[model samples]
Target: MYKILEKEDIAPGEKLYVLDAPDIARKAKPGQFVIIIIDEKGERIPLTIADFNREKGTITIIVQEVGKSTMQLGNIKKGEGILNVVGPLGIPTHIEKYGTVVCVGGGVGIACIYPIARGMKEAGNRVISILGARTKDFIFWEDKIKTVSDEFYITTDDGSSGKKGFVSDQLKDIIDNKEKIDLVMTIGPAIMMKVVSETTRPFNIKTVVSLNSIMVDGTGMCGSCRVEVDGKTKFACVDGPDFDAHKVNFNLLNDRQKVYLKEEKEAHKKCRLEERISGNK
Candidate 1:
């Protein structure tokens, strides 16, 4: 059991939970994730390692309570324990001074992109970040991302904040106006990443995206998070959660994310009903 050392609400349905996980923290790298199982009977879910403090012996996981396990995990307190927190898993983000790099993130994906952008900045790269959410309230980590980014833009679908459009709009403008961007890194919904990749492809920029594959074990054994990259089968947990965007098969990844829709709905309903019944006292 890993103790929750600290917890902070970063945005609506999103939280930053710092756990006393020395080993994982010390070994963790940008773009990596942890497979969390709320309890023995719970299903495993992979969440990105938003940040870590090696000397402090903590790994920070920013989770959006969008499903049953996450909701269950969120209800627990700082002093509580997470049943399983296995990782620093998958290939870490490849950081180098790739000159000017654009990092795009959408919705809750901002948390995952934050660490990667920070690393890129430390590597002496000029990082530009674009983040978008459905509304202003949905976005988080503005100051944090700003800290590492040489340039930053925020967008909301409803025009409630920064730019009034999708993240791709800002990205398009950047690609059109900015000169000499060598790479682009993005993390979000499969469709969003696909669009971002397509946007950058026209500019002949190298684009990288992290795959949120349906994972059980944070290892190659399960084969649940398989993805076709450059026409070869790759397991996301070990081979990557990150891949060359142009080489990834997005249509399959989109379908794969929906494979457990029915089970997930039932699980959410079960959890809510259980909560209601227990609260009836």
Candidate 2:
């Protein structure tokens, strides 16, 4: 059993858990993720490695309670033990001195992008970060990102704080100013990354996006996280959760996710029903 060292609600519907995984934390890297199951009968859920403390042997995971699995996870608290937590999976972010790099994050994806931005900074790259949310309350980690980034831009649709626009709007402004952006790493809603990639196409800027496609085993055999890049099939679990954004076909990916929605919802409902029935018996 993997013990939960700490857990807390960070934002509305978003919870953070720090687990006692000594081996995984020791080998964890900036862009990797983990596949966790709350119990033996629980469904597999993939979560980004939000943060890690190597010395302390802990890995942090930020989860948004969007579905049943996460709702169940939120019911638990610190010091509890998870049935299974396997990780340090997927390829780590390729770090190098890539000139000026723009790290983009949308909503809770900001947690995933923070480590990569910090790593880029350590590699002597000028890091510019662009973060956005539907509203200000949903945003988090401003100071952590800003500390590592040379330039930071924040955007929200409602303009409750930051600029009154989308993060894509900020990207256009940066390009308009003729700033040299060597690499762009984005993580967020699939559609948002699609727009970011489209925005940079005219300038031929190199952009990479992390795919959170449907994943089960989080190993190559499942083939659940397949993505089309450069007209070829690649598995996200083993091949990459990160790929060249310019070559990815977002339309296909969006369609696949929709196809499974109804079944996923039914599965979630079934799990909840069974738990309720057992509680009464």
Q: How much does candidate 1 score in TM-score?
A: 0.97
Which parts of model 1 have CA positions greater than 4 angstroms off? none
What value of lDDT does candidate 1 attain over all alpha carbons? 0.90
After superposition, candidate 2 runs with Cα above 4 Å error:
271-281
Candidate achieving the largest TM-score = 1
Candidate 1 per-residue lDDT, tens place, 143-216, comes to 98999999999999999999998889898998778678899999998889999989988778999999988998
RMSD of 1: 1.3
Candidate 2 lDDT tens digits, 159-238: 98799998999999999999998999999999999999999998999999999888989989978888899999999888
Residue 210 lDDT (model 1): 96
Candidate 2: clashing residue pairs, number: 0
